[model samples]
Target: MKLHVIVPLCVLFTLTLTQQTPSRDKCVCELTHSEKAFPHDRLSTVEDDASKCNGNITPQKTVELENLLLGLEKRLPQLQQDVSVLEREDDGQLSSVLSLLVVENELLEIKQLINRLNITMLGYQRLTTNTTKELVDLTAEMQELETYDTMQVVKRQNDNRRLRRDLDHCRNGHQPTTQPTEPPHGNCPHGQFQNISGPRVYTAGEYPGSYKYGAWGRDPKPGAGKKSWYWIVFLTSSNKFSNYVRLYSSLSSLIVGVSTPGNVLIHSSNPTTNTVQGPNVVLYGDALYYNCYNRDAVCRFDLSSKAVTTLQLPKGTRFNSKGNFCHLDECYLFTDLDLATDESGVWVIYTTTQDFGNLVLSKVEEPLTLGQTWRTSVYKQGVTNTFMACGVLYATRYVNKVTEEIFYSFDTTTGVEKFNLGISINKMSPNIYALNYSPVDQMLHAYCDSYMVSYKVLFS
Candidate 1:
């Protein structure tokens, strides 16, 4: 319960560009896992037998119905009935808008519990047990509606005592500036963290460059110094073809041609384009967003009009090769090992067909197919293991070294943990093959398979 070493800030220029050993000492990391033991229900039965994804729900049945509803702890009587309906609202300054409308009604009940996990992954195994007790009652009602955002500083100190006489007339017209606040665009200087923490395989953020090179996505231009980079990676080592889109060069391992427009066609009842295969890819900045595989809809590649347009999907996937677009504005987040159907609940493979694998998040306007949005069904929703800070988004179901259990986080703006990082994933055993996030240096880069390690998150 003690490990916070961290020291990797330029550490003499990262010991002259990587040789390994990225820790100088700060103290606050507790990872241990070894002597062999990393089963997560045997990696959810080997990703549900190499996922053809039929009736998804793995991560060992969402970590055994989230440890049988956290050992039947029943999230404090539904967070005391949402603090008694937020003390019957209407008290002034909205009493914190009734805990932000119970955190936006627990984000539409985690999108109706991701639409009841797509009817429990298409009724596979004939879902019942009251639909796995409604996925442990919607993850204990989205972690008691995001622990009421820790009472938002008691409503900003009750608006700082009614703005203490308009903050002493704006602090007697205070004026003394010389320019210095430019570090929050993509927010680097180690600041702009929404919230974070990982008991094992490290994670930390709040200022020092918000992580960029050590790890994190969207970075591929620039070469050397300040590492501003943009975005480009093409690691399809798992092997499966048919143009998923590729490009790289955070400076250079090579691989670069840069073309555009490829996958996006969920079965087009009106536009049709679904003719994709496997190996897919998607990125934003330097432009690259995938959908190919049997195309359930998602296309747009104008790296200077190489040409190709067909992005749209409001409801198309029980078979469209499941979802894509992990997370970010234009919407579109899909996952389909075969049938982890998503957007928010719906599972129906009975008697226990636990092959459920679905994840959906859509929103398309023109030529870019797919319309109407809102999704959730997480049938083993490990949408690329996920992690996004500040605008808030995390998802590390269970890491290891010592222990981990982040079911996911999202409400009070965003979150994704699935089990909550209290750790004890069946008695830990470290081997964090890889983990990343650096917003330039926001920290959270652990990799023990080849060793690099890091941490320091004090996120609220």
Candidate 2:
């Protein structure tokens, strides 16, 4: 009976194992292809045991094999779900790496564009510098030619006058008393202004009588008493910066300087439109050139027609409320535009931030148009005031109430700066608002504290 039962059970176990073999092979294949680690050694041992059971099988061994198969079947679905999750994570990591590479490429492109722009800007700046140099050279040549023409014309006129005088003497039947040879080049009708050997002091009550008593400038075009004109700017009682100018028939008279009684002209046509300011004023030809307050513009008042015209300054120009020029204790309002007239032409001296806040001298053409501008290497901060004489610029600095010194001289023709001048203004008010050099009488005019004073400018 035991032999019969054991044989039947063994046959039944063999058939059951044979039937499950295909399914077991499929599970092994899945495990072999998997990306995750699995126990291949255990699977191999189970296969060996199943093969050995075909020859000799026991109830205990059959039951153990069945339990192992059941456990493998139960774990299969969970293993597949784990593999799906791992695949998703790997895909995400790869996508993130690609995105980082794309961002890096974009940043590199932006850097390249910025470098190219910098190179272009460098080229443009170089071109502008070369152009400026050429313009300056051309302007100098033109000025020299104009001076030559003027000298020739003056010589011809004098020669004609001498010939006419000789003819008159011949007609009178008198030997022309040998006319004294005229001074060389008719330099200055009065001796070429003498250079100062020592300081000349002036107090509130004391002043030199030789220099027109109390006058602002050496009448550049001195002719008749009516031809030599002087002007004074006074702050209105209503507003300090809002001002009107008075025209004087003669600065030679002491009454005019003391009382400032003259015709009041050129008030702000429309005070609301623009305030007429006179930090500096240059009377040239037939117009009075001045800076318009609170705006980057210059105004030309036609003395004959009584008409006004404006010329715009460069953009980003500092003016009006912008305080760059300063003196001791106070920054003079409306000092930004320094107007001057000389043999060459009228010029406006101003400081510009575009040129690193350096002094810029621009020539004013007819109708208040801006012509050529020259940028000086000297920083504007060191200069307290600037004026032009015979096309040369003199810059002064505030030393004390008693003295102001000319420390720098700029030549517009050669674009050269010199520091050889040791000239100083003596015993002047601390608030010397304006300084102008006149080539006609060779004197320096100062407007300070409602007083107009003149000094003999000594040139060595």
Candidate 3:
């Protein structure tokens, strides 16, 4: 019975071992933890086994991580550079903020100053007008009283005889007279002005509308070798100022963008004191004259000597854009002073508080002296541009986009004004910033929206 039981046990153990060996051969994965077993039913292929055993990481996921790392590596240099720049800028950040604050304060102060000046000008205008009226009344009364005095009449007759004798002697070249001479009136060498022809020349020069405010023309009284030369001054600073004068040997050179020997620097620094301040400019003789920066004065920049001279305008003259050329729609800024040239010489057109913003014309004499001044009835703000011809001041007004009308004239010779001249200008641009008549060529030179245009002056 013992032999039979032992044989049955050996057979049972052999069958159990056979079953376990095949199961062990079928296992494809192993676990390190003795307490855990691999989930063989959940995995069907080698890829599934790899994903299940390696914390759910796949070949595609591995490639994505590799690409992310490469991208970070590529951007690391730029990130480092940015950090360095931030570090450098941190030191000056406070100073930069303070500087901006200072600039803002300065701007505020300038605005305040302008407001104060306007108020003062208005007050002065009222006082001066009253005083002038009173003075005229007093003078008229004094004249009436003098006419009733016999002794005063006799004294006036004796004085008149002495003046006539002095004039006769001077005319006969008999003796040196001590009478002050009158300023030149620039009488018309040609016939009386009738009308102006169409544009004879229109060009944009080299800049080609890059600048909106500027002036260009041939000199009215050029130096010996500079008769054919032309000049241009662009208000490159905020369209209100410039520091140089560009010279062209000829009109062809000006149109073709040919560079001359060099440009004349009004000042080494732009928008500074004594530099050009407005678009109204004129090349007279051997000097360039323009409005002085921030002052009611005319500045002359000598081409040969490179020296600057200033002629202060009359007291109460409007400036700092308080007085500007205007139309019904808009006003041109920084046009308080308009420099013009004619057969006489250089003249300046401005407005004064005393004149109630009407046009005031003054002759600029040699050595930068103020000559005779005339007050006009035409309101300055109504005029767009003005030029002098034959001792007459011609003013233009905006008619439309394509037309400007010369509807007003003030004769400096006869102290007469005409408002129905009815002359028209055909424009190539919308605005004419500067206009002057060249006596040498009898042509009108206009700086119109960065274009240099010329028109012939037709005289009767």
Q: TM-scores of the models, in the given order?
A: 0.20, 0.51, 0.60
| Candidate scoring better on TM-score of 2 and 3 | 3
lDDT of 3: 0.78
Question: What is the TM-score of candidate 3?
Answer: 0.60
Q: Write the per-residue lDDT of candidate 2 for residues 1-460, one digit (tens) a residue.
A: 9999999999999999998876534433443532334345644655565455333433323332332333334334434544454555545677655655544443443344344335545654674576566556555654544454533776698789999998987887765554422112112334422243221212221122212211134335443433445554444432234344456433322221222245446664534334466457766664666777567788877656777788998886778646344665666655778888765567888877778878888988876689988888776666677887656677777778777777676766667776646567763356566777766656566766654545666543
- What RMSD value applies to candidate 3? 41.2
- How displaced is residue 130 in candidate 2, in Å? 70
* Runs with alpha carbons beyond 4 Å of true place in candidate 2: 1-225, 237-243, 254-261, 268-275
Considering every candidate listed, which one attains the maximal lDDT? 3
Provide the global lDDT of candidate 2 against the true structure. Answer: 0.57
Sort every candidate by TM-score, greatest first. 3, 2, 1
What C-alpha lDDT does candidate 1 achieve relative to the native structure?
A: 0.36
lDDT: which is higher, 1 or 3?
Answer: 3
